[model samples]
Target: MMIPLAPATIAAPFARYSHGVEVPAGWRLAVCSGQLGMASDGTVPESPREQADCCFANIAAILAEAQMTLTDIVRINAYVTDRAHMQGYMDSRDAHVGTPPPASTLMIVSGFTRPEFKVEIEVIAAAP
Candidate 1:
């Protein structure tokens, strides 16, 4: 089982995610490496919106490989190349992963491994 936590003390999360997550004992946990927006063909999208879409799509595929779903995700760490892309990032995230969201943190960085890569997302999931 997973318990999503958001203390009343801190400001509410900017979006759908919780501030923290607690996974109970006896369940298996899956920790995913950071995923970029690269597609199977080694193509990266041009716009932040497109990249965010592909990034989450990639995450879904990886979790499915481990027999998990988005609802099973307990935590996420997201990074965007520029602060200007924040809205697009959140929009894409909302379109992909909605209710029963994970505990998460989103950051803006100077750049990524590739200049065209605008977004990266990493997740932790738990299942019985």
Candidate 2:
């Protein structure tokens, strides 16, 4: 269930992601740190698309560790090293998210910890 918070005066939709409205007083919350596109061997994926996929995969892994699924996600923040791959990343995210896209933010950044890593993701999920 979507918890209503005090409305913000900002018009920018992306702000909804960066400054997520406060959850209801008693609602349970989950805070996940950003997930990078590193592999088991510490190797970063070569392409933006591949890195994006891995980044989401890692986020899913985090949620799973907490006994949750993507459906539990209420908000997400995505960082991409290449803006040119926005469409491709959107396609992949759409395919992976199923339906009713969660509130999200995608941004292009100058770099990540690893040179080959092209994307990173952070997620916020809630449960009653």
Using TM-score as the measure, the top candidate is 1
| Candidate 1 collision pairs | none
- Tens digit of lDDT per residue, candidate 2, span 1-128? 55433356856453323234334456676778988877657777677677667777877888787787776677878888787867656665666662345678889999887677677788887766
Q: Write the per-residue lDDT of candidate 1 for residues 1-128, one digit (tens) a residue.
A: 57778788889887788888788889888888998988878898888888888877888888899898777888889999888888888888778764567788899999888788889989888888
Number of the predicted model whose lDDT against the real structure is largest: 1
Worst 10 residues of 1 by lDDT: 93-102
19: Cα error in model 1, Å: 1.0
